[model samples]
Target: MSIETSEPTGDTRSRAAIKNALGEQARALGFQTMRITRPDTIQKAGDRLLTFLADGRHGTMEWMEANADRRRDPRQLWSEARSVVMLAMSYAPETDPMEALARPLEGIVSAYAKRADYHDVMKVKLKQLATDLERETGDPVKVFVDTAPLMEKPLAQAAGIGWQGKHTNLVSRDDGSWLFLGAILTATELDPDPPERDHCGRCSRCLDACPTKAFPAPYQLDARRCIAYLTIEHKGHIAEEFRAPIGNRIFGCDDCLAVCPWNKFARSAHETRLHVRAELDNPPLADLLPLDDSAFRARFRGTPVKRTGRDRFVRNCLIAAGNSADRALLPFVAPLLSDPSALVRAMAVWAFRRLADPDAIGTARAEHYGCEQDEAVKKEWDAGTTT
Candidate 1:
């Protein structure tokens, strides 16, 4: 998997100076840390990805299976890519992110989604770095954030950014688990940084804290049972088994990342673009459930939560409402029983049953069961009535 690269025909001192300048420029661009690694450093990551896919750990994210080879080795993605420059941007929360869990009537969004999308933020900074590196080395370069088919964690670890924690997220001693990784792949041969080593020993706090027990083992994740995946990626009716465990997390889950002990040394993000928006911190489920498509887009216009679209996002809100035991949300959840999207309608049924009494559930089912066309929605009514 290693590619043979010829030594650069430049003054060694000049090259060292360029490397040091690049690090300084990256810091100036708001990246917390920057390091370099060869493309061949992550050759072994492909096999682990294959095993993860075979075990169905990726769930409905079929793109991972489609782009398997390119994700494993950066060389396959770009033939001339001899070196990878990895960058980490800190998005650690200023306040305790887990506090939102206590407010059952509020919807909890993952810490990263509380501000503008990181992909947009990171890509702009990465392109600036790539432009500078290309001008200095006179070599072609390509930049990628999370949007590309790259194993960012492995490459970041290879570049000494951080070790992949037991939760399979890049955990930095400096940035904790709140880092957003980006990469610059270039044809130029640059010195690689030393790789980071695992700091997690016998501690299984992350694994034990998962609401749905998504982790089968340390350093592995099953996306199907993950609340983050269920709310953000899974586009259909969430299995009844995971609904209660999903709690009030409307967009993504952060229980595992928030519990990591290494965060004791982590500081709040200095990047202004990553600062948490006050409105999104702990949005009321009642406020979110009433949003139409246009209103939803307007409310979360620049944030990551908008990408989930109104249907999926409201569906998640309904799940949170069901668990909230807040009867006040019943009026908001009632009209959605006839929502155009079957996904929303089914969850509305579930939420209605939870908030209403047995007599109210019977009365509502009697009125709507015959009019429901989607078999799944009807099944929800059936399940609600029986239970």
Candidate 2:
């Protein structure tokens, strides 16, 4: 079980030098903060993950269940790893994201997804840091962003970056809740930093702020009811119960993160690539609803929203259009009634009913129902007609 130590075991000066150099290098590579931790620092994270999986709180994300072993123990994923370096890059927005919720005509996207994907931006920076660390210490290293099974948050907490807040997201006094985490695991046995202590005392802002009641309790999340999960992850029809509460949010929800008291201390991202594109910030429902598959790909090419695909993204737009009450969006929603995706067509039916009068709904039903083949879309027509 013994691993090679890059720095001499008893050499405090060497350890301090390496740690200081790493912090300097990481900052130079665009990381706002960095900390050192051991591979085995997150035993509690593994236990919590097992409980989360057993409770089926992760929804359709079976990858979490499949990688439980490697995720629980970083050493299991890579036995040769001796120390892990955790890094954070702040993507805090220039304006409050909650403001978008009030504009019913616009589809609110989560702040994180409004910019170029963090996985791509963070990985390039993370690899540079890992390469430098390996060359300097002669240690083998592996880098990861969110794509990996490695528990970056717990490991970040263990490395003193931040504590897991009541919303189960890492919150920093310096950066608030707007940090993207990255990890670099090295086979160098370095000294671990002090773990961060919980600072979220008596605060329920994040929990009370959830639109879908995603947080079952403090420090625990039920992904089944999360808006982010429904819009971005879940592929099927969104349940009837969550649609109205979803409001104008078409991509992902940010209520919990935006309402956090710590965000007052947050700063806007300085990295150009991380800044939200002008077109994506609270764009109109009319603007998004009309996008075809080709247009959708052209519009969201480099962002994470593109990964949600055209059908689901358009379906989300229909939800926004229905809730908007603007009625001007009817023109945009009408064309989608015959959208090739049953998911889109079903939602178009539901949205059309909410925005259209009873006579309009009856006429539209007579015109569109006979040709509809998907049972799900047919159910929407039947429900809308009955109501």
Candidate 3:
């Protein structure tokens, strides 16, 4: 349903008319809401970043600090850009994500990344919207999803799409917290909407629900303690303190987002492609521990899980295997002690300690500790045997 474009009129009524046209286009493009946000001083964006940084919550995401000034103000990214069009697409899933946690032997994927890569899904739509805006206004449009330094959550909140919940994610009344944010910055000067008020009130459900205590306080997250960060972003040895608490979440953690009471209001997504695949939704920890690069790529192609690569992802699976208490999975994790990925080898040793018996451990040590190149894996193996 393409809206017909009219010749540009430099009148207040003309701007108002074009805004409605843009809004209509956004709706037709499957966005929940679209609002023009004035590109002005980003006091709020700066405040959010400053607070998160001062608390040492960003963890290993050094990229967030690299473009601090540009992240705060969108105009720094493009001097001529006047108004930002904030768009949201709902990717809500049907089943309760909490159910996966109870099945300790199965891996739990975060709600968002369980399906097709959102960048692939949303970036195409954003580019189409950009093209449409250019056709209608004869002006340039710059689109951004999660890829840019721009603080999308703050921009979405300011654009009246939603307020940042205690989890520090934009949550809309219509879409709950299951919406993916995208932005299209344009030179067209559309009128801005009033900023949305904080509707979070006394609700601390998101904070209370976190498995790893990622949230230090309302609206602040300590990513160092976040399971999502540990599994996906942090490249080294999984921290000892957070391992067991991570449970079987091998890819990313969604405990906080999953527990939001507002999700009751969320309708299931119409996008069939966003539906969770059976294999990825609850893959067995034993099955995931041994996926070589080719098998991982073949299985996870077009899915967000591929980004972590086979080694990092399998390392996470090893941790989940350690915590599974299945004991049946011990033999499966045993061979990974000689895994080429040092991180995987280290985690395999931990899993052997947790899941393998004295006989199994002795056998693994006798057969492969000689071949173990990683000092860390050897240390864990020696400690596991001695203890």
TM-scores for candidates 1 onward, in order: 0.96, 0.96, 0.95
* lDDT string, candidate 1, 24-85, tens digits: 88898889999999999987777899999999889999999999988988988999999999
lDDT of 2 by residue, 1-387 (tens): 112236653477677777777788777777889999998889999999999999999999989999999999999988999999999999998888999888999899999999999999999888887887787677799988988789989999999999999999999998999999999999987788999999999989999999889988999999999999999999999987899999999999889999999988888888889988977888888888989999999999999899999999999999988888777989999899999999999999989989998888888889999999999999998884422
Residue 288 C-alpha lDDT in model 1: 94
* Tens-digit per-residue lDDT, 1-387, candidate 3: 553546455777778888888788888777778877887835766877977776777877888888888888898888889999898888887888888889998999888888888888888888988887777777898999889888888888888988889998888887788998899999988889888888888999899998888887898878899898999988788777788899999998877888888888887776667777777887887678778999999989998899888999999998888888888897788788877789888888888888777786788789878987778877777775422
Q: Which model is ahead, 2 or 3, in terms of TM-score?
A: 2
Q: Who is ahead in lDDT, 2 or 3?
A: 2
Colliding pairs, model 2 = none
**Range of the 10 consecutive residues with the lowest summed lDDT in candidate 3:** 1-10
Worst 10 residues of 1 by lDDT: 1-10
Model 3: number of backbone collisions:
0
For residue 261, give model 3's deviation from the true position in Å.
1.4
Q: How far is candidate 3 from the true structure (C-alpha RMSD, Å)?
A: 1.9
In candidate 1, position 336 carries an lDDT of 94
Give candidate 1 regions above 4 Å deviation: 1-9, 385-387
Candidates in order have lDDT scores of: 0.89, 0.89, 0.83
